[model samples]
Target chain A: MAKRVGMEVSIAVAEAVKLADADVIAAYPITPQTHIVEHLSELVADGELDAAYIPVESEHSAMSSCIGSSAAGARTFTATSSQGLALMNEMIYIAPVLRTPIVLAIANRALSAPINIWNDHSDIMSVRDTGWLSIFAENGQEALDLTLASFRIAEDPAVCLPISMNIDGFTLSHFIEPILMPEKAEVDKFLPPYKPQLWLDIKNPISIGLLGGPECYTEARKATDDALWGAKRVVIKAFDEFNQVFGRQYHVVETYRHEDAETIIVSMGSISETAMTAIDEMRDQGQKIGLVRLRLWRPFPEEEFLAAVSKAKNLAVIDRHMVMGCSSGPVGLEVKSLVYNSGLRPGISNFLLGLGGRDVTRDDFKYIHEKATSGQVQARCEIVGVFE
Target chain B: MTKPTVDAMAKVGDLPMGFTAKPGSTVAFKTGDWRSVRPVLDREKCIYCGFCYFYCPDGVYQDMGKDEKYYKADLDFCKGCGICAHECPKKAITMTLEEV
Candidate 1:
């Protein structure tokens, strides 16, 4: 497939919405995510997408509308950033439990106290356990590609959880780039109309979201948990199906020349882009360095992450945010947990970097790469070069 | 005064799975111990920020109608968590749990 030139991240987002053939879009504008929804709303206004562009009063209503639309068996989407995501916090817990395959684009942004509008993991990390299958995108192309991928994974009968597709706030979402938009016909062939085994059927008129007692509550949770566990394979299937259609490959945990490299710096979201740039620059200088990027966050691809790092003698897991009162950084904790379970244990440890929208300069990568190679692994997570 | 029979019992929602807030099960509750003397938000002092509503898991606070200027806390459901009292920014809903 030839690359399409100059489509902004927001427009790439719009293109994905068109490809997914979403039935409804209910979203409120909030910075970075605003552009994505603005483009999507324009697509709706221009008669490009046959969908409802709901100008909702608040992010809560935006998610509520998505829940309502998805329940009616309509393929639904919404995008939000920063405080908008905070506002949607209530419904964040509800959409997945309802098993509505609602895909949302979360342009990752910092939540407020001092009220800054900058790129940070604070917003998405807050909803980490909201039961949505989460994926982070590295660039504009991946953003578009994964938005389409999200639908296939989300609507999979075995994986009926809502999917939140994350693009870094102001990093990828605002950055202009050239990318490929797959032919709508080909995309349609890949993703069929979402047929949820559970939906609101007017003619049949079945009950949805019934209040369960102690007896059924556990079953409801088990159903969603089982579906998530089931999603592990369904995600691979969806990726395999996509790869067959296009020559592109999708890995839950993507490796960029990570094989056999003794030391690698690992992170997610836009930090992966910086990490790769570091890899390219260092590799050109004859340094045997590599990188691993976690594209999928939820359904935490533990087995795949282990395989990616198996050959490495040294590995540094970089987290973009803090877990607050703990010995763990959020991503660092997950990586450590996976290592603890894997048992095959290469020389793996954790590092905290690029928190609260602090820029991870190319020089910063050089520092982290050095930390990866400096012999002794921290018995636990280390704050990599972050000034105390 | 006449008491309603079991056959004539009025119910609200459908029975979910098992017992609910039933009349005489051993599920202990300290409804009496849960009482507090928080200042009923004089609606006049209410800005309707809705913080009280969000903080209340018991659905204790709700607006009665469209014209309702401020939400009133439902004393029936209020478990006296005092979360609302502590979180109230305007110091409007005060706690008098202790007597002056």
Candidate 2:
């Protein structure tokens, strides 16, 4: 049985992990991500969830503990944001290479110089190349659903890699929303107990994460890359199965009325919802615009993304993280390179906005549309709404 | 049991997932070639106290039993760190430069 209930998004994500029957949770409390681990610790303490809640001293130990537990054939999980994620960077890169199928929840936040704790994509963008299967959720429901799906996708024998489910901090993570909470039986039907292909067994021993001399280093890296690219198939299959079981459909690249539009606004995370509202308003006024929401960031849904924007003559690629000194933001760079390689010449305008908890209103989306369509958008990334 | 070796010619697809290898696979990778010096045992002064066997970092020194006069170094895996010579109470073992 699945029932819609009002719940905090972070708590809902924690509940989703419980539903997946995680064996261990090793996490340090950081703002935005703290509530999720807090709830998980409560669940473990109350005996509602039968899992080890390791209160690690730092985020680095949290991820390292997860790798050890996951390697020992446990379904492991953890959550972090911003500086916490940065601290886990070293272990984060090692997990996938060691084939540890740990599920990580990231509350996307702004990294610090002034030390601000707010919602942004800067945190996630920093570790974009860590070889983890990364996905974004635009709302509480998606965040919950993706958390469950990540465990399934990561533990699959064909895709034994770590996964990070990113939810915009404060905006999406701290918000209370009505989410369809799936029962344990339903979740069990969707995601069975994790069966690892390789694990630390005393009787039948195997060594993992060994030193790769130059002789085999390239081959090892190539093998991991192939596994990551191959994970897209498992992701699709898991989502399809989820649809069948839970009656909620999800796509790697979801679109909002972009089939016949002349211009498309590309965005990710919670800001896409704002873009959708703006698109609806523009449509009412008879402007030919739509939105393409990127749900899967890594193993970048190449063919699907190109197909989604193929008919559009103009594209407003909204990026929340500023890749300093680069010509464009991270998402913008990805889109430009993708389109260029695909031989498509769409006028793609990269807009950087809503950084460090700055509000991104519907008008901002409308402004981006105007800039993109007016053919005055520059080759350089535009920082929107900076105080003069 | 013999350790498994990764084929040098194996393709990317043929390699093991996660770069995992059989346990104790270092047995196949002989590190003795890395050594610039070798340990020489003087059976005459050796009291066979087993200090060399315990001190050798690579487990290179093997007990030759009471019937034999001294312990022996398994040169096939020894890296010639000279820990055995340093730890020998009888001073019966010495490190000698390997002939280039």
Candidate 3:
């Protein structure tokens, strides 16, 4: 029988990584994300999980070591939060450039200026162009499920790029939630033993990370881009297969009561859950408002997002962090870019809210819907809940 | 017999997967044409200490048996980096301009 337990999401992520049977884990301790690596270390020490738990000195070293281990034909994993992810930025770029299939669990935290340890999308947004497959988890169960799915997707021969699974720090990471943990046998059936197509073996030598001249640089970059796009298929397939085994379905862009709704609120991470409640509350009052949550952030899920929101007259995007100086947040910017190109002119209103762990209540969602529908939102985006 | 520069296993053209074969697979793509300065090893002054063999980044020096007497640089893979010539203990190696 599968085990169901109430545990912290970080601990659950650690359990999920262990369940994936990762060969190596390299990570450093960072707030909200510390429990993940801590638990993973315990599993390694207790001999419950047979893997190398590399307690690297820094996040940079953590990622570098993960790259080395993954390149050496090992299924590797690592976890980090805001500043930790920022430190690992260079290696994050290299991981995809080398096509190393290392799974990174990011407990998304706010970036430092005042050095706050709160949940936000700033960390992951900072490395958006790093060419890794990115996914967001709405709750503990999705975090656990997606962590397992990351390994399956990243290591696929067709999609040998690194993947980052984002779990909102403090909010999702610290909460003790009841989750159905998959049996090792079932996980084993869902995910096969990883056999790397390309590896650094001494016996059969192969040159990797060769210097590409002006002639080959474009092709090299093109190859990485194409690999990420192709990985979308493998990602969708992995989620589908996971659903088949676990009986919980997931999609790139998951909608909640979106049909027949004239207006929809768009968001990602745990905030989507709040939006769901708000949407349901509004729906009961005979408001045609629904929620559209983006689960897959990277590869952008353009087609699905467009299809999901095409019928809606208004799109209110709730971004946890803003792009600063830009009219909207990164999600809003990308959504606009996608919508603009498709020639679907919806009155898109972007709301920057819940930054630095601020509470975004159900009332806030209702207010956003009102502002968006009444055309009171400024030019493109508005900083909601800020006292002027 | 002169072997072809690119072997069957060496990946040529655009690598869509970024998958490369074995370490030093660039041996198949000879860098001899990249030479501006070529190292000339004098057998008379050479002590066969294998410093050139040890120092050359490109694995240009080919060791013929264990003897110090028959060490020769394979021009096919040598990019004329001259680290071998600079590291020669006995001053027996000279970096000569290539006849390009």
Q: Give candidate 2 misplaced runs (Cα > 4 Å).
A: B1-10
- Give candidate 3 misplaced runs (Cα > 4 Å): B1-16, B32-100
Could you tell me every candidate's TM-score relative to the true structure? 0.77, 0.97, 0.89
Tell me which of candidates 1 and 3 scores higher on TM-score.
3
A27: Cα error in model 1, Å: 0.4
- For model 1, the interface Cα RMSD in angstroms equals 12.1
True contacts kept of 2: 0.71
Which candidate number maximizes lDDT? 2
Looking at candidate 2 chain A, the ten consecutive residues that score lowest on lDDT are A208-217
Which candidate leads in DockQ?
Answer: 2
- What is the Cα-based lDDT of residue B4 in candidate 1? 14
Q: Model 1 segments beyond 4 Å from truth?
A: A1-3, A284-286, A379-388, B1-100
Clash pairs detected, candidate 3: A205-B22, A205-B23, A206-B21, A206-B22, A206-B23, A207-B22
Ten residues in sequence with the least summed lDDT for candidate 1 chain A = A204-213
lDDT of 3 by residue, A1-388 (tens): 5789999999999999999899999999999899999999999999999999998899999999998998899999999999999999988988897899999999999999878999888999999998899999999999999999999999998899999999999899999999998899999988999999778877666666666666556666777887887777888899899988888888999999998888989999998998899888999999999889999988888888999999989999888877878888998889888999999988899999988888889999999989989965477678888898
Query: How many clashing residue pairs appear in each of the predictions shown?
Result: 0, 0, 6
In candidate 2, the second chain superimposes onto the true chain B with a TM-score of 0.84
Candidate 1 per-residue lDDT over residues A91-124, each given as its tens digit: 9987776788899999898878768788888788
